[model samples]
Target: MSRRRVQTLPRASDDTVIPDPEQRHLLWARGYLYAREPSEPPHPWWRSHELGGRTLHFDPRLELSVARHGETFVAVLGIAVDLSEWLTGLGDIAEMLLDHRLRSRSAMIRALDRVCGRYIVIDGRGEHAWIQGDASCSRPVYYSTTADAYASHAHLLAAVTGSPRHPRFPDPNGLGKRTYAMPGNCTPWRDVRVLTPNTDLCLTTGEISRFFPRSRIEHRDPLLIIDHLGPLLERQLELLTREHRLLISLTAGLDSRTTLALSRSVADRVEYFCYEFPEVREGRSPEKQQDSEISRQLAERVGVTFHTVPMPYRYPEEPLLSVTRANATLFSHPALGLSHLTSGLDDRLHIRSSHFEVARRWFRRHGATQIPVDGKEMARLLTEYHGNEAPFVEEFDRFYALTDFESTEDLCDQHDLFYWEHRAGTWVPHFLAESDVAYENYTIVNARHIYEWLMSAPHRLRSNAAVQRGLITRYWPEAMEFPINGQMKEHFPAQVACAPDRASSRNWSMSGLAASLKQFLRGNSASRHFR
Candidate 1:
């Protein structure tokens, strides 16, 4: 029952020995990839399921919960919680799928849109097949035009189709520090592309189309949104704890704090941890050091088991990097540290709050009045954060070209949709897939229902984390004892303290006029949410 003990493995003295291309390819090609044809399971560890014309070849290690009826079949690859009935797991969806009301494809999709959790569903009836990922599209479903097939990993698609690697590999040099996920539903391979979130793929015809935001994203009162989100997340955690151990990632930020607060009901079944990377210890960033310190303190006050994972000084070398690259084709230096971060942590669900960014309107530039309408403005906003890299902009242009804006442009800001469908959709899913080789993981907020609720709230409240604050206050107000993201208030001079730092009992003395003037000059008070 004690699962936190660190495991020791043999170390390679020569860290510089790079694996050959073929060996790397083999490593990348390890996971199961589904195609539109019936066939025997590819590996002994793998299993196959014939869904009409579609065949799912997946290792037994992966979760593939299937529900069947006369001619319709539905399989979910991860956890799915049905909010209406307070039901949990894939089997419930299976039973729900058997309902005559959901006999039609549109009816089934509408039902799925109401469910929450990180999962990808494959629905089949006779020869017609449709695939869709979770709300954030964190579990990516990539399709290859050249092979006329869909698989989880791009490299796996290439390996099965005998297609050559895209020139961008090793260094496509895309934006961001953690990974280089090509913008706008693009993957590392030219022939293979990611299936955008809020969209569905027709494996029968290789056609992809939008399925969510079916109506306008209506603005709701903050309390109503939080009321819905609180119980849903709490119930999900309860269901998950009943089956699997959890390793909740904590930090000084509000997102993680929200997750920690919601896990209070299931505290007995979960533990907490924070990374102490070498760079942070060496003073490259004091904020990370504060994160570790705050996380440890929170765990102590909450009476839960916690670990401080010490990371490697330099990037992990050779085999580790190779394997990471194999799974996470678009990776950066920090991904090498995943091995150390996950060491000794196995068979536990790694819960993160990264997907919560959408709730905060992550792409909304500070001091901007309107959203970016086209690819050019979108590229400028992206370049502002990522630098003026031609390649990055060009890739974004391609992503824009591939998107179905006709269906989505009217519902919400295009930037918000971009952050949802492309950035979080493509980047986070591959990161999760890469980490899967080390340990299982999922984002707590990876659900369309939750996102729809969050985005539906008033922008001012959502931007300042009114929803998260309310949830934390509702479940575990003790989490508010510390400042969020190391700051005491949402805006300077504490015009409004989002959450109190009860430990220090510190208060700001600046007047409202001063705070107001400063906020106006700053242009974008939205920046604080990301801090």
Candidate 2:
């Protein structure tokens, strides 16, 4: 279906309301805090309904609530939260956001520091919008030249502007899959820009600055960092527990084992479950029998309830298309179908640990000790991403320039960032529910503090997920007793990275040839082999 058809489609339900024809002339948000006056005359969709010197607009589907304090304005979405802890005695969230500092003892620069889920804080005085969201970009923040003064949703920008559909810079291969990132804040369209994680773009000065974890791994013992990571995760889960029934997913890998271990503080409060594609797993990479069984054993060990949630192997085509549309086409290939099987999960929120495995990949034994990745391999990956050798190789030099200095001490250094950006940044979002149903989802590692500690830790601590091993030892030492994915690693390894056997596409498949062609016909241009 075309973008216009999506915009014009009648309201499917109360949760999703379509804008009237006239209102859609220029992208605008209504009903939500993003409500604005109709545009002057010709571009009636956007009018001069200025709120404190700024024209407000955001995605209409957002479960947003608006509030004001003095010259500040606040709009929050995704996670339903009360900022009292982060804003205790701090008064209004808007005020704290506006001052960019707090009266409390907390650090000032990280104003939105502990706030969970996707959030946007606006300074009514200067119209300085501090927009931030989860690592998955579930609510992709977009900007275009036509609306150069501010940034909004991707679909909104595409609707109103002549945003050229071109990427100014070169990106890596398999963009929407598990391999590469959006590349230098580039999105599917050159005209529309994605506010990449760690970046905060100011509407007033148009200044974009780093807005992620300000802390790094402390100069502490590896064991100590492991201790710190466990509590840090508990705190995050504790924070989320206020509004969500934690659903800890156990799979055949280390990610789940680590997550479950760290979640010990609230084990009783959480409900553990296992999900797998038994039908789809037939020909290649079938789900291991011991995988779910181990998970059940682990849950029993934790003394928390564990249930195996069955998923469908053959997803109906139309529903898949709807999911594709809802996810903004950021998801393609085999991962798309997996979303259906797991769609029934509700009430319980998921803290996906898929991307966290990248850090651990550093330690696993790969063919001979890491061979420095060559430019030739890099070019090959890029060519595979665009699916066309000509346009891909033409800019191979640009791609090289963009990821310069990528090859460092370890093989992971060669792939970790891209993996984090693409797998976590792109694929993880698709795993989340695309419908209006309010099943909240977040990444296991989006918390800035955790990221800082992990990145700053000595490489040895993170390699082979040495930190996870330490966490498992400190939290759930018995995990060492349970065979992880049929292997008794003295230390925990990926239970099935993407944890919960999210590795549906790990191996290259001949079936991918047909799947890629279907995706192409469905409007995805990413390479066939990469998918």
Candidate 3:
């Protein structure tokens, strides 16, 4: 890293035309859109290539891809629909989605008229950025202003501009503890902001805008939901089966079974897999072993293949593994202990059910067991973990008022927004990287339109997982023929409703939280590039 002249194309003998290398840095998230006065000649460091109908000017990243349609630009860093051929003729997102030839076009239109993917779209012509990662920002993006340029590569911007990482220069928009792992438009570092799922931002003025799909859609009758969902699910299955050598991550859970039910049409092409792990508690049976059998049975009944990969709860000692684990997750959360599962696989598309829990009233308080929904409760629920309680106390009103202002959305919608925007949205990209050793890419089936549709309908329809259970029965009643989720000896909706798990553990004492903060601050600096 040194100041040097930029190496441009074979320069004319007139060396005066070769401007000095102004600045160069990359965002940590695989791909990025770097704005340089919006009119500067293209940088010398950029390399260009064409995919689908658009062009990408980048090197040095994985999972980042971009394309262009007229003046609108589409860039994706994580999992997204392959619109390369379809988008070559990109026009209005709505019209493109409405095409009779577009696969799953109906579902796409209903789902915000967006291609299902954890991605960010930059409309160069519009001078704005759209983050379409659904409510859970399983994919994440960040941007900051340093010196004279607005940038997504925060650390590099800080470095190039001679700004301190802390002290003199600290987090201006830092996330509170509870919302840290899933922060939206907030980061621990000063001047950097996160792009939560389902939100967007302007490139020039740095003004933020958002699309609230819940307030826009109409709620048809609940029974009609089932009728409507069949085709949407069918479209998803069709898309998955046609392009992917489908690998379904199975478990003895309603989420996966619901997925299994839909995959039945393409059962011949599908393969099911689950992990078999050792028991964690004394005298406890191996839950994963039993779960493996349940998944095997479901696949057998559906007439597809099943494979159980034996996994150890603890991965063996390897120094490099720890460093990579920290960087992959950015030390935001504790390791999930899935190294054993992801370490030995080849790159293949994998699918699982995430974000399904929040779609229903799963997080809402019931009659006597309800959690409070007041300002204090909202602040504590969101910012409690921020190490020091001061930030949480200071920011609670803003958090509470934001959720409270959406008049038409139900309380459960508040719950979903918190998870979708901050928790799931920010967390999943890291989750995928931990398993990058196994798959080239992966996606959650219950992403995007599904979340919007769930939030649009009355909570009662989805409460008790009525829609989920009803959908399962409608599609594959026999899969529920066996006990699931430790609900033994009954054929009733196997993954029936259960009480919510305990709320998050108490926030750390100030000193302890501070220590954790210091640890995270030092995290990325130690790890070498592993992916």
Candidate 4:
């Protein structure tokens, strides 16, 4: 199917617009809408369909599919892959799921999370309903209680409800070297709130609560998890390549390398590119230079086509910036202004590295072994970790008060969940929404099943990048021959010593590996450098 932006949509002012006014009347570049008892379409240009008590509105640029069975119905907007049927697409998955006896909205949401892809699922029986987005919330869902509606962008709800901006976030136009995303599930509007990942929203009651981590995370063998992830990533990539031309972002980081390794089987079919900004091109950014250079060298070695695209930082127009401030909290990201560079590649799906940091202990404090006792401590950690100049402690405290983490205290590390739900879920998706004006994006690591495997692996393996290294070796060991982040694998004695040997990964027992790792950590001088 051909995808193109619909620029014919009506527009008023920047404050009145939702996402990208140039795209469509939808929330973002391609967004969905859920309004209860709407007299007409949310916008004159959007196509509206009634689903029981609610009306679903979306632009023709978006993918919308619905399936009904008996009194229950399932509608999915955006792309999704059925895990049970790896080759099946979202439309088939929706119809296939209707055959199953999903007893409640909770059960339906759980099943939808298992389906790997970026999208939002809307399901309900009769007048009662629920809404949730993909794992890691690649497609975000925001709700306004005053408007009694659900949408892709928070600004859309605010504009519809005429909700005044929250006093705390008065200046959305502020930009600096470092800026903070709106803490927790709070939004810029007093009446609107963002839906955190792994949480479900009830349309009828307007209640939000966690539905994941239903049970404690069990420690699993790293090799088993690696084995499971290797095939899943490859199949997902293969499925994507067959349907759409892919432009996978390449870099000198382990995350992007892991993505590259997974795409080895489909390398010939995929196009690779690295963003070459003016800073890197002018030798001002050594790190970005390494990213572009290494990616180019690796692609040349693998005999795949690669391009170094110029990504000059151009300030967005006042009108675009105003609408962006309304839709997203972190407006300082370069992607917000670089849409002009990527908008021409509308036919290719941009794949990038996101949602992989949860396994890397991203939020862990150095030399601190104990977990933070409560939300206040967590807020303090965020302040220090993210270096926020704004007062996030109060927002975090409020968020902690509303969330029920006590129910999941023992399930997994609270810090990891924070990264998954708060960091990646909130930050990454908002950036994606902002960049949606350019080209659609996807990440293979967006699957909840992959996250489960990553989260359940032994801590030592998960934190040290051994799990990722092992997965890469499983698919394409040759890809690792290149240096990662300017450091060769052999130079990092800790990684070389602790990395699971791919040949015998399956033969080693978890307890045996854990014992060896403990001994290695105690004796190795480089252990201090490892996180």
Q: What does candidate 4 score in Cα RMSD to the true structure?
A: 6.4
In angstroms, the error of model 3 at 375 is: 6.2
Lowest summed lDDT across 10 adjacent residues in model 3 is found at 499-508
Ten consecutive residues with minimal summed lDDT in candidate 4?
4-13
lDDT of 4 by residue, 1-531 (tens): 422111122211223334444534323456666777465555555667778587777755567777776557777777777776673555677765554525665556566656887788777667777788888888888888676688888777777777788877654345232334566677778888888888877888877778788888787766567767787777888888887889888888899888987887788899887777778867898888888888888888767878776665645555655656555656645444355345455467788788888877776634223464356555555555444344566777666655665566788878888778877877677777766655577888787777887888666656777678777665556677889998876311223333344444334456665565455556543242232
**Candidate 1 Cα misplacement greater than 4 A, ranges:** 1-31, 37-43, 100-102, 167-170, 173-180, 332-342, 366-372, 385-398, 490-531
lDDT of 2 by residue, 1-531 (tens): 211100111111223434343323112222112322333222232222345454554333334333454434544443423232543122344344434432431243365544435444443333554554544354455655445433444444554564555653323324434234343345556666555454555665555565343332234444446646665565767777775677777886988888887777777788877764555345344455567667777777667878776554433255444433433434333233344235555545666565566565432323212235433443344334334344434443443343342433232244444444434554444345332223445555654445555654444445546567656755666666687667776532223222221123123243543453344324423221221
Best by lDDT: 4
TM-score of each: 0.82, 0.66, 0.65, 0.84
**Counted clashes in each candidate structure:** 0, 13, 15, 0
The per-model lDDT (C-alpha) reads 0.66, 0.47, 0.46, 0.68
lDDT of 3 by residue, 1-531 (tens): 322111112211212223233211211223333444332223344444432222333322233443443434444443455332322112333333323213342243244433555444443333433333433555445556442333333443443344444432143224433444422234445555455555555555555555455444555444345545655664666665665567778899878877776666677777777766555223257775677778878777767788866655444345434533432434422222344234344334667676676666543532212244443444445544333255444444443343342442543355556556545665555655444323434443444555665555455445546456546655666666666686742211223212121111112134543443244324423211111
The lDDT of model 4 is 0.68
Winner by TM-score: 4
What is the Å distance of residue 309 in model 1 from its true position? 1.7
Q: In candidate 1, what are the lDDT values of residues 274-382, reduced to their tens digit?
A: 8777878788878888888888888998788888777765445666666666577665444533553457775677787787878787766442334445555555555
Please state every model's RMSD to the true fold in angstroms: 8.6, 13.5, 15.4, 6.4
Instruction: Superpose all Cα atoms of candidate 2 onto the true structure and report the RMSD in Å to 1 decimal.
Output: 13.5
State residue 451's C-alpha deviation in candidate 3, in Å. 2.0
